[model samples]
Target chain A: MTVQDIGFGTASAQPLPAQKGPVTAARQRRTWTIYAAMCVAGLLPTLLGASASLQAAGIGLWLPGAGFLSVGGWAAVLFPLTLALFVFSLVAWFWAGMVLGPVIVWLGSAALAGAMAGDTVWAGGPYAAAFATAGIGYAFHRRNVRLRDAALAKIAPRVAFLDASLAEVRAQAAEIPDPATREMTPTDLAALRYLLDRALQPVTEWGGFDIIDQFQPAALRYQLNHMGFALGIAQTAYVPNFHGYMGQAQRNLIDKYLLRKVWGYWVYESCWGHLNFTNWDPAARDNIMLTGWFGMHVGQYMLASGDRRYLEPGSLTFRLNAKTAYVHDFNTIIGSVKTNYDSAEFGLFACEPNWIYPICNHYGLASLAVQDAVTGSDNVRRYAPGWFKMLNQEFTDEAGSIIGLRSQHTGMPIPFPTGEVAYAAFQNCFAPGSAQQQWAIARREIAPAIHPDANGKMRISLPGKGLDTGNYKSGHTGSFASILVAAKEFGDAYVAEAAQNSLDSDCGLEIRDGVRRYTGGSNDTNTYAILGQLMQAGDFRRSFTQGPHAPSRTGPVLEAASYPAVLVAQAISDGDNLRLVLYPGAGEGTQTLGLERLQPGRAYTVTGATTDAVTASPDGRAGLDVMLCGRTAVTVTPA
Target chain B: MACCAFAVYLLSQLLWPLRWLRDRLLVAPAVTASASVAWSPASVAAPVARKWRWKPALLLLLAAEVFGLGVAATAASVSAPAQPSVEFLDALHGSICSAVKGSLS
Candidate 1:
């Protein structure tokens, strides 16, 4: 099927309308206001005919170097350079979130300007201002940390109260059968529709994704990888044998990822961030963020659909230009992970240059696990033991929470929101026991936040202003999505339902044109939410490790169908028989579907279709007409 | 004034190659459905990867530096009677304005 014909309708084929989202817009406005104020402050010195030293000092405040206009001659060159530096610093600040670098550069340039003008006062004035700004920034950071610590201290007692009740909740969750076996509900189909709407569009089109800062989670790469993940999980759990447009949708995401626009940022990041100008290949060094996440994404596709195309040499080549590209395949990509893990002093490598994030390392570990399952290798066994040891010894805090981030250079922890709750689901793929314990602790800690809403349904209420790291915005949608993922992974239905309720009620849940999304959340959070919605008990672990069931591998499969007309909720097989539950995605209508892998020259008894029996063609393909209204079930078995 | 000019000139010289590299690397071929393949090593036309040539840029930078130093020396000789700080600041101001004007043009 063509890209437009795969999803619900032409609207679904188009990219989702670009939205800055309220939180991101507010943050952008605040940043612009700050810059504007700085400009006004700089203009004051120039307007007042201040001393050369004061005007030079104003250079640090004003990005446009308005103060430098008075300091004529070759010094005029500084104006252009100053403007360039300001723009560069702003970009660096946004990309890396490091305020100190910009602070140093701005003040340093001011001081240099003063020194060059033979003004001793100008040289010292900017330095003093820089010191004051730094001290104030640090104070605010520490105060926020203290307030957070105090808040968590208050919740410490309630954690014990909830810990006692978790055992029975978990025991009850154990009895729930695999949710994938049942037919997908309308809500589930809608959630899957959100993914399909984005994935089915042209690779160049970025609809329905947050395009804020490119350095972190908001980058297109992270969004693409996560979408692949959700789709791979849906494939493994729901429609393993079906590889018509579904498989193509997954491949399209991978294709988009290979585009230079999606990943070209790494080259600049490598040059400046890592200070490595020679080799800009993203997969070569310490970017576990790219290699690890991408590895798991590609490996999951292989495992779920049994596609070995990526395993071919140079299959995943990252073309830098007409002349230069980083040629890699599944094995080479995994080889990079192994090399990084082998050489890493912290036993976990970094995402950016010097920042080590345990959550990202968990992705790396899961990648290893998936690679092992896909290739029948022993990478998880070879690496996980030491990886866990380094994680515990170096990365664990006193409260037994995984430290969100640490400086590989300084060996100091930076407070990020990644705790047990965020790590549990990914960690489950490689280390289920540790993952279970993490979920147990996370459930207890988050228990204080779980309370009844006005409708008496349980929901999560995170303390303080919620932060979505994806967009660097303020929201609780990401927190709820993470909790939902963990809760579903370990069969904690009580919390899963509660977290889902929070996402639905609190995070602006919207369904339009048969697609579901949380308008309040970022693309990353929405993807995570979809992943949580599709998952059931053991689904996360099974998708990454064990993959689809053996019987589902070789069976009569639904090969082609009209999209938005025939929605395949469940297209699974039992070695010989193909079972499909179709829903009318656009509206109720009759649709033709093609089936493959059927036993040739055999008459098949088809139920819930227009024809009662149809013989397979000589090529093992057959056409059947089915009328879809509500949930219509069709079974094709040899007669 | 001369020192400020020299510093700005040197900084630009140092940053030019990086900017050149960035622009070159960011240039990517547009992908379409017909051009897209599952996996093919043959798709990437292997050309001899060229190393960045710093000699030409460096030569231009060196020539500019010599020209700037000669002009500074000549200006110093002509304005030798003025107070050193006043002369320096005035020259600095003049050079900065000219540099700014040159950039805008």
Candidate 2:
């Protein structure tokens, strides 16, 4: 929905008095006049200048720099128009408290600015300010918009616990009067069941889709738009009977009939959340937050797409992918060498959730794998050759499993990494000085949670809250020094397992007396984990958390049918199992467990720094099992 | 100045006739003409008018370009170790403009 759509939600029948006030009439004229003037003056000039320089220099459309396309032609065309749109978006800031609208306008401005300069050699550095501006502005605006968008704000809260019980859930569905629906296949049905597994996971329960986060809510803000778009798109892709709704017939139906009176309430915020922690006015952006969120949001949807829609063919996306260059978790080292963005070079550090921080390499590449799955996009493909090359360089070891860096938060990088036997490792948590951290650190090495313990569960917690205001983190790009393996463990089960093991932070969220508490240690990471536990935990875990406009939720496991409802539609098209296995004190053959499940006959696994392969093996493992010096994966044959 | 350098290169990419678009039976006559018009060299050239202004414009552009060049150089130099071919090609790209300009003018 457009920015103006928010004002129409209340269904207030307030007719405008025809020219009752001259002042009002004059104000309208000025708004349009100035907007027009800017188009002719400010916008026209910027476009011409860019077009001229690019053409004259022979930079062409395929600029060698990063952000080349996103910032180029579109910038020249839409930026000026958007500046006008930004002013209009602020109406929400006035009415929606401070959460939502202004951020959209702020983001519009920054995105436009990025478009303007992304093609240049020194683009992202200077352009970083625009990103920062968008992040902070959007965050502030998010609060404002949330306030004004009452219908969206007032969605009836759902009972999440109702989702947990498998039998109860099925019985509830059976109780539904409608008997006309056809039963789906076991595969499709099973997929639906998977989504229900952790229906109560934080990201999902909150409606953010990312499912876990304190700052985000499922309401009409983030979910209504971005996540909503994803869900809606996914629904269309999966439903055989669903005719095209994007074009005329469907749009006409919605516009003429359905939406004529549909309340703007229960809408999504914006798909793109803003996080920037940079020098461009802290009030404007938080470069760390944005870079982190950007990596997460992009990875979540981009990696999920089963189609090429995620890619901009013949575009910058196809040239310099964010997946490979930015390096979300263990990205500092790779990005340090490959691109200009890094905590080492630029002071960009912020709090990102999950394990694999400081430098969680497996999660880093697994995250990139997510982007590739979305479209197998040309851009995704371009970076894959290089990304896998670099990822194995530092992250992988002699065996097939991963080897991750343990952030020296409490102290220094020990030569013998904590829990060296494993392929991937993450600090118990980044807060070495925390009251609880001493206990975690003193435990000696971090161990991969291979088997469910007495509790039959795993847990991880959010690291120390707030931005880094000190020397160590900002200097070393180590603020992520904690763990934010946001997109680790892409397709390989082994990799996924290893990556998941790193996120052994606090996971319990038991709410009491309307107060939600973050109980220590629930090592659940990834959509699969949250979805999985909620499915299995059932009523036992109820009263844990609530959903948007709902009572404290219990037993609300998402059905596998809901996979399309989460993440981007494109991601579902190209399916690749992703993982990152961290071997627990590996000696000879400890590293290759997770990757064995990969369909060897159909899949070709490569390993080592140059994506090398295993020529032969002493153990007489299948030739594919003999993963080269380092990493490997088996997959369903690539389409 | 850059416009002069890129004109030939850009034209080269578009050297082939855009016949499929115009000759296609399915395309409505109305849009086809405009589509071609949108890509015409004259239309593309018109944007240059607003850019070619006074000394300040040049200076601002020069500064931005220099900064861009510096960034390009650093990245280019860093990658030079693994791919000498790239380094050599970059050197070649740098000289192409000057070399071409000398002959064309």
Candidate 3:
């Protein structure tokens, strides 16, 4: 049913208003008079020696800079006119979307000012800047406001219903006593296992493909990181084939984003294409928001598989333009990260063209720790001190929580939610000390709103009243996932279980092809659940507190003639015994398998197959032909 | 000073058609329709019913003033050897003055 069907909007038989009006001489006269008055108001200060400061402050409301005020005499005329042009452009933006309105105002004003410049070099530069700034800023503001308002309006009815229903459920739930807490049971482990297995199954690709039109590949990068996290942790957990598959997957993701002469489009067509502002990148490329996320995924893979192939020199090359490529080994990438810390007066890297997003940066810092964990790199140890110092100085609010989306140019926090509920667990990965501090504040401030129902399922509410439709999910599934992650990391099993219970109750799930997929939630939210489940007390702590762990043997437990070809369902070896499960991803043909890493000097018999005997070569390799079918298991025992 | 101001005034007048078109396309229809609904004849008198007689006269005078300003600015700028010629302003004044003078003649 439509929103209007539920009585959300007025349903009228009245047709939409007519789209034209009659023009009259009087109207034309009025328009001219107003136009002339604006022109005169704008021109008086420019043509005559007048108080340009007064004109700027009186009409523009605020002077842009002392430099603008420094332009004395006729040169100062552009200030008030810039202000007038800005006001006009705001009205124009109610009509035009994107950068068109601002471009028009900037160019038009500059062109007009050029007439007055004579031979002056910088006559129209300030005017052009002022007009563009005002127009573009106003347009961006309008767009954000419209989005916020529309979101609030669209979700109001549903949120209201949810609030009232959830309130009643919460009230009923409160009567029941808090359930006894315990460690993760076998049942819980099974559920977690099932979720992890589901994550492994090939699914629809995540991440936005809009890099050229509007550079927001964040969704894709986020999903890739979480996917890496889920699979990376699964290596140590239950998934047998995860170690090999995850190693390959991590390599593929790293290779895909590493700006080589691959992937149909030029690197410039993607988010990474616009990397270095000082280099061949566009003016919008200097943001540090993406490096952290990419680093996190790469780091997770390296940590899990202990493969340092990515770190070796001549690993990845960044294509700047034709014949100009910057080769980046892991050290160079990590070194570039150091530059962000060194250069940042505020110790924060920008996520957007101009705005520094704390959450995205947290991912970055965590990635640095991850790098330190995998490679014997001390970049994090070197840069993190200054980072934390700058972060506290500039990004932290009065309550000690880092500000979300602060402008790097202005150093002012954008009014986006940077609450602990959204970021605490994520920060826990890179900076456990600061994360714990934030969590302490969050637990005190946010713990009260987490009300348990009769089933001990918690319903979390944001601090303020009214559906913060701007971010509706944060108080619900997002909160549950974040809390669960934090609780798991901090050894708060009770809260973690409660949060998990809430997630299970609220976010419905479905089993497809024996893979559990969240039916009611977003990919990111479900991925967050995976991350929360993957959290171990000393997972990231060992990386940050201590240093890089020694690399583990990341090769597959078993290899077939088809190297990296057949998708192995599972493979494990215990001393002299070997077990391997294979799944032919989308085929039914018989295939020969070669044992690359199985124990050497062993004789084995298939339990069900009519094979005389299969012996491992002295080099610990064996070959066997098996039918590629459902649940094919082969056991090898030393004789 | 008056010359530049007048040139800007002429520019605005010449650009009026574009402005009118923008208003018609983007702003005026919705505004006029809302006004019509809010002040329906049943609830309020028609605003256009009592027309002001001086509208035509005011429009004519304004056009003349704008034309004069554009001509004077064009003359002064052309006479000054030190002042650089702006192609945009020159084109604007040439086109607007020609169009207005032809209409008047």
lDDT of 1 by residue, A1-639 (tens): 221221110111122232222322444466668767875675466468676656665655754442343344445456556656666765564456343555655665554454444332233434444454466559968975784465446334434443454464457446645533756678988888778766877777665555554687768788889889899988888888678778888999998988888778788778766777778887888888888999999999999998899999989999999999999998888889899999987788988776788888989989999999999999988998888766655665433456687766545456676777878788879876566656666777787788999899998888886876656557888888889988888788889999999999987777767778776776777888899998888788888898888888888888888665677788888889988898998899899999998998889999999999999998899999999989999999999
lDDT of 3 by residue, A1-639 (tens): 232222111111121122111112233355557545644554444446444333332222222221222233333544555555555554343211122444444444433333333322333433653565468669977976674454335343432343343343234222321111112322333334333332333333212111211133213345445656655554433333234444555565555454432222223332232333245321123344446666666666666555667687767565656877666666666555566766764566655444567677777677778777676677667766766655554554322345565544333345665566566556666555555544544454455667878865666544433221111222255556767766665655556677777677765654433334343444445566766765555443432323222211322245433422344544444434545665553355677766555446667765422364677678877777777675566666565
lDDT of 2 by residue, A1-639 (tens): 121221211111122122112322343456557545532443332345564323212221111121222344322333334434444443332222223444444432342233233234333322432454356558867864553353232222111111232233233222221111222232222322222222223221221122122222211122222222222222223221121221112122112211101111212111122222221211112222223222323333222221122233211111112332211231322232223122221111211211122232322333333333332433234443443333233222222112232111111111223221111121111111121121121111222323443564532222353221111111111111122211121111222233244333323233322212122221111222322211211110110111011110111111121121221111111223211211111122422221222223343344321333432223222222322222222221222
Question: All candidates' lDDT scores?
Answer: 0.72, 0.25, 0.48
Which is the leading candidate under DockQ? 1
Top model by TM-score, which number? 1
lDDT score at residue A125, model 3, on the 0-100 scale: 38
Better of 2 and 3 by TM-score: 3
Model 3 spans with C-alpha error above 4 angstroms: A1-214, A239-242, A259-278, A281-285, A318-326, A454-456, A461-479, A534-556, A559-595, A602-615, A623-639, B1-105
For candidate 3, the C-alpha RMSD (Å) to the true structure equals: 18.3
Instruction: List TM-scores for all candidates, in order.
Output: 0.71, 0.22, 0.55
Question: What interface RMSD does each of the candidate structures achieve?
Answer: 12.8, 26.7, 19.8
